[model samples]
Target chain A: MSAPPLLEVDHLVMNYVTEKGDVSAVEDVSFTLHQGEALGLVGESGCGKTSIAMSLLRLQAENAVFKSGEIRLNGENLLALPEDEMRRHRWKDIAMVFQGAMNAWNPVYRVGDQIREALDLHFRPRLSDAEATERISRLFEMVGLNPAMANRYPHEFSGGMRQRAVIAMALSCDPSIIIADEPTTALDVIVQDQILQELKKIQRELGMAIIYISHDIAVIAEVTDTIGIMYAGKLVELGPTVEVFARPKHPYAYLLLSSTPSVTGPRRKLAPLEGEPPNLLNPPTGCRFHPRCPFATERCSIEEPPMETIADGHRVACWNWREVPVSIAQEARP
Target chain B: MTEPLVKVDRLTKLFPVSRGMFRRPVDFIHAVDGVSFEIAPGESLGLVGESGCGKTTTGRLLVKLMEATSGQILMHDDGSMIDVAHIGSDDLRRFRRRVQMIFQDPYESMNPRRTVFDTVSEPLAVQNIGSLREREDRVAQMLQLVGLTPPNTFLFRYPHELSGGQRQRVAIARALVLDPSFVVADEPTSMLDVSIRISIMELMLELADAFDVSYLYITHDLAVARYMCDRIAVMYLGKIVELGDTEEVLSNPLHPYTRALLSAVPVPDPTYRKPPVEIKGGITKAINPPTECRFIERCPWATDVCHSTEHPPLEDKGGGHFVACHLVEKGAG
Candidate 1:
């Protein structure tokens, strides 16, 4: 058997305690990221894509509570670790590039100094200030930002440059895994493409695992090795990127792939999935996607679908996915 | 040829910059600089570019959200041609009924406290065109038109109670309640989910047909523009560098900027990836830019003439396709 995955999240369930009641955000979410591989978590907003990413880092807000789950990094159960220990593990073992990180940097300090501070905070006592500065310069170079611009304030850099600075800070400690949540959503097309390519190149050179999260299917397809489709806090479809796009098994995945207009491909009439996403507060019974899924049946509403392996490394949670013919809209392969 | 619904000529908007505590004049930010386009009756035109490229500013200008520094916005409705740029407040109010706008963010556009009925009927109320009961009837009809079935069910619901897609539908209903001849939608579906974007887009097209509305659709998404617009205008730093039939411009681009933008957009297919083009330097600052091609510094095919000369005029090539690049002008591309 292959070695254990660099990061493994098993049966994770997260809930947020509100004034009204406890709201289940992510339920029974499980996935693994191998060494030097990338996994993309994709879904519409409030679908628990961000919740799962936050669960991995233990960064959920005070209102959030993990009912049951095991977050393992390099075979060690991170969930079982103490808060102080988990804090130390963060950035050293895994780092995150947040959504809107372009504006996340401190405006008062130099961009380089902020990166250096991350390095010092994580790897202090062993790494001197001079050493941290050197690493910060190298990190900036890796992310395609000029080391000379490190002294410049956040306000001085463009949106793309600011994002690059954020990436540099994420890599300050040489973390084994990086979780990027919608890193390029706000960027222009050219800048977005450049950043995606840079991240891919950096991943190759460093041999680090990445969990890229985005709502844009095309953006996720471009960078991720494996794609995990989420809906209402459930992992609907988990499979290789090519297979998921080319031959989607789940109805939600198929609908998502077909609805989005492609920059390249023969234009077809997009048969949009009808109805809004189900309210997560009081989600639909059984399959969360059954409300909008065209192929849903009587059995689908009464009993929850089990995640079964249909092919090698491809898992789908649906009762009638087999009976449901892979529609022409989805098979418009390039 | 029939008169176009809207015509913009030499449209420009410069925002004054103040400096120091005394608030002395510093410089101007050319948000929309010498831009011009037109939408024929019942035609859809797309204005596409990167963020801060003045696509939104152009849309706002057409709707008279901000007065232009200089230009002519001539609205030809029925037979009368009214100059929108210089219209008085009273005339502006009358002009607003003919042209309306759908904002980008549905969350922020509609009032959180207002019910769906109130939100959709607000435009009719502002125009003072009907009684309260008549406005309610119109709002219900619009809700059904936008596919919010059993309009009574959603009539009293607040924005917070609806999903992103539902909120956008309500927003669209409000924009169309006035029965405007023209609508300017600024990235209307960018905030919605990918799975539901096409549904909203199709709904808009369907409504356009039913209402006989012309659209000035502004978005950064090329694929969406291709699907929605008959003609597309590629903007760069407040100037339209290319404008043509959507299929013609996309399949066979003339301008270098257009080509770069097309290549950079991420395609859904994983098997094919366009090799990244070397887009040197940063976005051209719109404030006091050099008197050259706005895309000169980053353009790979730029020559000395591109930098030292006046801004290239958008010259018509064959078949109504217009391009502003000198390379394209010389037939070198």
Candidate 2:
């Protein structure tokens, strides 16, 4: 617990500039990733979860601009580093398993060859042909894929297999951190479960830090050790996964958790959070969730709430966090 | 119990796969292989399965969007059952008045050029049930019923003008304008955002009661199915492996495939740990599928009995809980 964090994101703010206007995609977000820790960012669509992931890797789109704050890996600030210097850090220090990564491979190239390409680019002191083959095979095996299938093209593999290959490619560089964005969104439930278990197994074995970004809270709850809930562009809540799921402090977090339907447990009428997410281009002043929050007051619309710690490693950014129900089960009753 | 609203008997649909230089039909994909179920009046039935499992195809077949290769789709008419599977184009038009479909993607299902009024009133115009003025009133009423208040605002708007949730509401309005007795909604809210999805589902439930309509709601998410369906049918590789009351099927899954599927669903409780899924690999191509068990390739409990015999027949174990598995004995869990 005394070790310094592996990655520190200090008050990160990002925007997408367009002719229409600037979209405030990420607003004053701050978090840290310790070595071997698994954290999940859960939110609805367009809540800037992906924006944060892209910011971590400096892979934001051409129009994306970082307004302020820093992304520090170890003691070095990634934002201040030169483009060439940053390029060297990519994959070598931090790799990403992109959203909808099942189709990440080029159709024409063999799966093994595509993974080898990553090794050829980032893995220095160059591996010999035999050594590279051994490493690629090992990578495939590590991801629960048959190493023999690596010679097959992407088109030949199933959706689950392709996803495994994508994970293998991400780990080929042996990065200390892996940022997975909706890694299993397209696969079936069974396949998704298998892939998630495989990712957890790989993370545990390699002792690599992982940042999982997903819209599905259920998937996040199962895999992540810690959870961060994003609303509009802000991280509204950060806590241990069990603590957050058991007692969500932020109203947005509480409503989102209650709205999700579960296969197990008593079937309760899911209370849908009313209204759509706010437009980032002209988001509501003060609390971004104020417009849709049932507990919002005039003061809430005028003053933004700062993240406040209420328990060990549990923080909530809402003026009415105390008023928010302690548990979803109590609210479900009439 | 009241007479069922619709009964699907041994419904099957096969798409031929062509290969070789001459492009000959060498094989057939058994999309819906001898599937059967019933929808009660004012009841909702959920058909859930993984992609390419023919849940969508079954929905399309029920609404007569696609012709079935074989089987009977019987609908209760004024006094007797009518075989809708082979209804001629003339009778098909009349049958269409009683049944309507809501597609998965509201964004793509609606034509961009058509206004909301045009889309919702088309059914009334096609059925010739009301005059032009009456059709306009009916469309407005349907829009209000689907929770799109101030219907005048959305009446003339094109598809592109509405948000995703509003578009789906418009789609619902269009489907319900004719007051169809039965509806086949194929993954209606799957495309919407998570928060928006629940509202749409609740709206559908409210409309079902208001209109007194039955629905064959097809989806892959069991949680959504559990919410919307009174009874559930689990499909796999063109077969219904399990069918029962939604609570019964989910609480006590009998088939190995169903058990695996139920176990794989990630519950939202971080403290809850599901048993490990016992299946292996993903759904295989159904082209010229073997006559044996459809789930044999992945079922962990598959034995020689599963391979030697023909595909297991769906039989009620107890209290209308049906399963199609060789190992699951009668009267057993």
lDDT of each: 0.88, 0.92
lDDT of 1 by residue, B224-314 (tens): 9988999999999989999988988888788888988998888887777686666765576788777788888788888888877888998
Model 2 chain B lDDT-worst window of ten: B77-86
Q: What would the per-residue lDDT of candidate 2 be over residues B1-333, giving only the tens digit for each residue?
A: 489999999999999987877887979999999999999999999999999999999999999889999999999877778798768888888788889999999989999999999999888888887888988888888888887889999899999888899999998898888778999999999998899999999899989999999999999999999989999999998999999999999999999999999999999999997899998999998999999999988888889999899999999998899999999988964
- Candidate 2 chain A — worst ten consecutive residues by lDDT sum? A325-334
Q: Interface RMSD for each candidate model?
A: 1.0, 0.6
Summarize candidate 2's per-residue lDDT along A1-334 as a digit string, tens digits: 5799999999999999999899999999999999999999999889999999998889889999999999999979999998999999899999999988888789999999988888999977889899999999999999999999989999989999999999999999999999999999999999999999999999999999999999999999999999999999999999999999999989989988888988988888888889899989999999999999999999899999999999988989999999998799533422
What DockQ does candidate 1 score?
0.77
Cα displacement (Å) at residue B170, model 1: 1.8
Model 2 ranges off by over 4 Å: A330-334, B21-23
What lDDT score goes with residue B144 in model 1? 93
Candidate 1: which stretches are off by over 4 Å? A327-334, B21-26, B330-333
| Model 1 chain A lDDT-worst window of ten | A325-334
